[model samples]
Target: MNLIKRLAGLLAVAASCSAVAAPLLSEGFNDVAALPADGWAFINNSSPPGSTGWFQGNPAFFAAADGPAGSYVAANFNNAAFGGAVSNWLLTPELLLVNGESLNFSLRLLGEGLLDRVEVYVSSAGASTNVGADFSLLAAFESPAGTGWLDRRLALSGLAAPASGRYAFRYVVDDTSLNGNYVGIDSVSVNAIPEPGTVALVFLGALALVAPRRLRQSRGLWLLAGGLAAGTAAAQAGPDGLMRFPHVQVVSQPAAPAAPGPGGFMAYKDPVTGQLTGPNPEQAALLTAAARAPTPLLRQTPPAPRPAHGGISLMLDERQARYAVVRKAPDGSVHESCEPAPGGLK
Candidate 1:
């Protein structure tokens, strides 16, 4: 019996070992200065009056870095000298990558003044097709507000094209304002996501550990079966179940109650009984009545208030044109004191 218990424990351990692991695809762009001649291309999309793409006339801008990590391009869009609008550049290939699964990369916009946006596109291959024109936009990322450089990440899971063959990924800068904007993209890799068949192996490994044992005659075989059963049982019991072998009972700890405290000028209490009181309501009301009551009419003048430009717009969509008002914070920061606003995107 003791031997069987040990076998069951082993089985449970095996089950846990089976699980899908996210992996890297392919990477590029460490040397933006010398872009690969064949597989890549870029073009500027700046407005007529503004500078298109980077100053050197290419869509991507190059820069020098500090380590064996070598150097890479600093993806900047804001050209202050040109009305803060820079080129909306794109990089693509002639072939369609239908089965392409993941596009993994890193971005750092090391300052508060910087704002960055990344857009991805996909399309099926066709003769005489303008690959860029036929491409369908997939994912777009906008940098969050802050001072120090931010390490940004995005997982390309649902962005795969429906058909196989020719496919491409494009990066664009949609912002046209110069606020010390600078961005760095590296380890730019694209690889296929794991096939369903590969994922099955992970599950099978886990199953082997926790499954029931067979009653085959050989003692070794029985022991192997028992270990798997035990492992399976242990996992099903959850973390607290580990104690089951020792005949221990589990107990849950209860949470403590909240303490009372004063808030704002108004006193608060349980709505059932108005036991809470702070300011004298009667006295305050009498004072207000006296002040408001009509008196020998006195002339009065009103002063003007300062102007402010603070409003939020949530533009959530593909074309990236129209915007919906998801949250309105007249005071700036989001107002969630009430029920939470629906999904936050703009």
Candidate 2:
């Protein structure tokens, strides 16, 4: 009988240890300048071209008391230049959600007498640059004319099991009219919930420890004890004998193409290949004008005569002047190239 009580106490301790929740992902938007870094992506789908887009920063117009001091993601839907129509999306990094997990986030509304709506979504389909059609609606909320933040939690355990082991969150906002207010989001987190089997194990263990000795000797109690122990072991081992949790990896995107140079020279290279591409249409006209302008020389003396093969040399020099390096092929053929420079520029 003493041995039975000791075993039950051991099981109860194990159950309590296994019931502790683990954090999967947490982000506070503390670094405003690097808002969408670490796999986060912001997408703007506003029509008429001039609508404001989502950005990360402290509230500019109306402040929310709960907003952190550092920074928060926000969108200005009421800009007059764009006619108050705003459609934007913020996506989370790819995560792996095991059974019994929950997502929590906070939202705040800025300004007075303006309405804004936000919808949360989860996708198990695949990594997408744009918000595709495949996603499950998690929750939706409309912020009344106010200046405070609200915390929200969603039980993701109820969602269908994912075959791919990858999931993401999408925050969609639409503030078509009455754009005086903005929306802010911060303190996003994903955490694990204790599995049901763990809870059952704890309850059964306590009952076995306190129940009369005659009850423990009953056949039905013995069967229930065996089942609970098996269930607890199965839960602990997981499906493939490995415990899993959602994890976020930081993925950096390629930098955008450089704009036209101040002197109207098109010195940008292709992002994939290091080959120099054509000029921007807006800057191509400027290039033509600059080409026609008279060259200015510090010294008035006539330039030295060029070599007979100077044309190729001049082209090579021009490529070098634009920070492109020349590489020689294995066959000894000189190839002009504009490789990606240090500090993420090409």
Candidate 3:
């Protein structure tokens, strides 16, 4: 399937299941001055540098693609009003990019007959300001271009992203006063998404010939923080510190005994209070639930500090400890059992 179809399907499933894809960074340029606070960088490399850099977009030229004229960001030849070469740059905040990501933005050029140039660039050097050292042109639009707003997409589908990098808009001209004019940029965004092939595979894998309600409740793929699952899931930080995984629920749990372990680390509990503790709340809940098990459990130990993408295989999904609910019927009957879900999708 195409990206749109697959993305739509993924979103539909993600409404209930955990989702992973989302915008990595977005800049509307609504507040030009606030860019510095948000980590946006501006540099003027014009030969014998010009006095002006990027400023507010002019309403007389055109309104933004999505907001007021002031909402867009613009640059002009005013950098060298008297006449000098110009090579000004406006850079996005630092980003941790990866494969299967895309940069999206809208561009507009003023001065129909005059010399105009706007170029998009990417720098693998994270915070390096030396334009000459590590900048590669991604896209460039020269004079005699269309007068209306131009929407553009630059996919990083081929080159793998570096550890750190940045996208930049470079306004250049041989002679600013004569060749350069005005340009506006708006609706800038960088979206992080799964590879199309992977999305398609997941969408296809989720297909099962089952009842409509059951199908809606069952997905073959479920995403959690930094990982994926179908039968069980990892956990994330929440207000209650509870681990909410698809197809399972933790109803009740016990607090585990606490004491110091090897290397002065608490053993599955807080040393100070002897209360249940964990790498996170969800893990803590799982430790407590395991402690309450009828059979002796594994030697409980304090979780070591996890690195990025590090995961713990801790989950509590059972009738006796977490999921079972006891009910006393109106007719003097009692029942307790785990509710079975269709194919463990939800």
Candidate 4:
């Protein structure tokens, strides 16, 4: 009975641990030179054109006044050389947002420029490029000049959550007066919110762990708790009944060709098309023999233009283009044709 209670306690703990949601996306701009890569895009929409748009790695653009000495993406309109009006956008990669997910990032502002405004937009219909057409504003604010770095967190539940497709964050800055003040952003992240059901299950599991020993001893209670735990565990397993971890899979290179066959020819099967290619004399002889067999001959469609050297060429027949083979005759006349090329062709 004590062992049973311990087992239940362990199960409850495991259930609770597994209920925590994982981060969907995280990015920290430690290397300014590597910016705008890995799906991050920057666009300049300023009209009358000479505005110096967003710039990264500028020593002036730091996340915090006295914090880490690293780079952050920044936009400034105050000292614009091509000054008339400035509109710039920094976009994040497509991100998947669920009902209870949230977005967070760190921002820093410098100078007393009140004319500059920063707005954050989100889109589900398409890329968050257009302001009024595709993306809807999520939040907007004027950077309070001299405010060092500030952490911002926004709840995304029920906001532009689509069944499929992507969500992009469009950060826009507009300065009609060329205030020259700077707005910097860093350490952006998106995280999922654990579902209520998961929380309830975790709570129930915890409660089961603290139940009176007498209650734990009851066979019915044990069966009920065990069944629930099993169901939860099964739900988390992949289709093949194995636990699934979210991680990138590395594709391995193709395997080397098979050893030479008895006829000194090597064969390899295409992983994608499932077609087999071989230089085996035995297989070639068999194909040649089969071509000479007394099978009824049918008219073959003219072959398509030959491909460039080392390129794939398809040969079609009246019925269909099933296979392609290059045949060499006793007289050294080489012919390429579709599968089962008419039994005899001089």
Candidate 5:
């Protein structure tokens, strides 16, 4: 039981580890330089653009997801003057989208809060700065509810295709100074989901390939069992066993006329159980030579006996006088037949 549990634990660990697919793109805004180095763009299309756009993080509001205080990126309502619209866009570099991709990031509202809104969008393929022509909204939500950080994950497969595209985070506020607040984005990751778990299907496919082999083996086994049950000289262990072909078997009987023995017995070697013993005991009358053979040696049923036409008789299979009759016709022709035995075929 302990070994099984340990094996199960190991498989679970492997699946969990395998499930983490390598990221197509990852960004941890450790410093402001990371923006220009990775071709990230900061576009402020605010109506009558304001003074502030994207800027460095400040620990006074909230710490970074990984590094020190100022190791993140932030956007605020200052892009537009008080009571004016703020449309600040933080766009990612162009990426090849082959479908079925995902992204996750941590975000938080900094400083005094408002019911601010941030929206995510994607371009058709390679729309560099034409935010108007190609970009389509992917998601939108109010700022994180608390002062602490919030994690968000999104599936891009539905919106993306086998082309190139860009991701953009748009921070919009109707009134700059009233409902606007600071929002920080950190630890962004884009990855593909992994695929596994094919061994069981492969195993069932293999079984389909071996079905014919099993059928052939069963036929040989049946022939072997039949010979062993009959206690015949044809016994042998092989793929074909004894029934490779049919041949006649002979069971000799003693010629006798005393009160016939009651036991169904034959001279052939019985099985290891020694079940072929005769009807007469040592102190009782001796057994007749025509006593019936054991049930295993029988081949047919019993029929009504008829008088020998020319005083000649014969026997067939292991049936005795009680089970069958044999005689010679007047023209010197021999015939043998049988019907249901005394009790039953057994």
Candidate 6:
């Protein structure tokens, strides 16, 4: 059956059975097939004025895990700008909302030099205002903290719940302008904590699904009872929690453009840290402008003439002297070009 039909069948089954809701919401990089417009905004010590961000790629660049892991949107970090102060680079993704649900999410940031910290900021969407607790993933002077695939799982339980569709995330690299480093993040997913009773029933039901057939029906009933109770209680919890129940399936996705064709001077991830080494925005712009400048060609002009003299034979054939000696008279003139003079003895 087609995917939609299969989905409908699954929904029908879910309606009949007591559903144990899944805990996560994942926004895959390729979900839109193309990168989201304004999904990411970047800044670097090297960005040219008026450019969006100095991310690498012809049209756009994307982030992905080669295998097993998933993919996500990633911005390029130009490390060259951190001439000496410190090797650092920072990037922030669009906001997220737990919408009042507690959160368990995984974040990864790996790059060259030192990745000082990956801080989570809770703020009103579009407003520069901080909402609740500002969380930190790393402390200052933390070297190799998030370097080389540091997998961090965060649980944000007590922060004020976010309203739907409005939240913020920011990553700060210590001494970014001084340090040349970049970060790669993948597979960000949110896990919503289920209520206590709902959790118990989910476990029990899950056990039965794997157990012998005889226990399955009883567990199924228990699962249904728990779901109905949870659903009923959720109605009181208002739209906040109830609405969060569905496994947020991103319905439509765009395919990522094919990997870039083979080319020269590609950036590489640092062995210690997965950070990329590349020209920053400023350097790139300077190079671009220089390449487009017009060049001027020039020709040399001959020197001016000196004054003419009385027939020192002004244009005399100098080569003639080599064959036969020619002597000039006391006057400035040559004696009508004579042959070699005889020696007095001869």
The residue pairs in collision within model 3 are 247-346
What is the Å distance of residue 240 in model 5 from its true position?
58
Model 4 lDDT per residue over 25-57, tens place:
777766655655776666665555454556663
Model 2 is weakest, by summed lDDT over 10 consecutive residues, at 256-265
For model 4, name the residue pairs that clash. 77-180, 78-179, 78-180
RMSD for each of the candidates? 23.9, 21.5, 32.1, 24.0, 40.8, 20.9
Q: List candidate 5 segments past 4 Å from native.
A: 1-18, 111-113, 143-147, 159-161, 194-346
TM-score of 2: 0.50
On a 0 to 100 scale, what is the lDDT of residue 329 in model 2? 72
User: Could you estimate the TM-score for every candidate?
Assistant: 0.39, 0.50, 0.52, 0.51, 0.49, 0.36
Per-residue alpha-carbon lDDT of candidate 5 for residues 1-346, written as tens digits (9 for 90 to 100):
3533443444344434323555878888887666866878888888668888888888877788777787888877787887888778888888766444666777665535464656677775574777765676655546424445667666665432367778888776766756677888888877764322232233223334432345654454334333332332232222311112125343324322221112222232235777543221111112221221245766677764656542224443465423345667899997876555454443
lDDT of each: 0.40, 0.54, 0.61, 0.53, 0.58, 0.37
lDDT of 6 at 77: 35
Give per-residue CA lDDT, model 6, range 1-346, as digits (tens): 2533443344344443323434445544443234335343332333222222323222222235432233443333333333222222332343444433433223344444443333333333542232222222211112333333433343343336443332233333323454324444555555553444444454345444544355544464445445544653343232334332334332323432222221112233456887764333233224333543579767786654542432222223533321233457688776554333233211
lDDT of 3 at 56: 79
Residue 48 displacement (Å), model 2: 3.2
lDDT string, candidate 2, 53-79, tens digits: 666655555343344564666766633
Q: Write candidate 3's Cα lDDT for 206-275 as tens digits.
A: 4422212443333322232113333223333233322345545556434222211111111345568887
Best by TM-score: 3
lDDT of the structure predicted as candidate 1? 0.40
User: Worst ten-residue run, lDDT, model 4?
Assistant: 257-266
* Predicted structure 3, TM vs. truth: 0.52
Task: Choose 5 or 6, whichever is better by TM-score.
Answer: 5
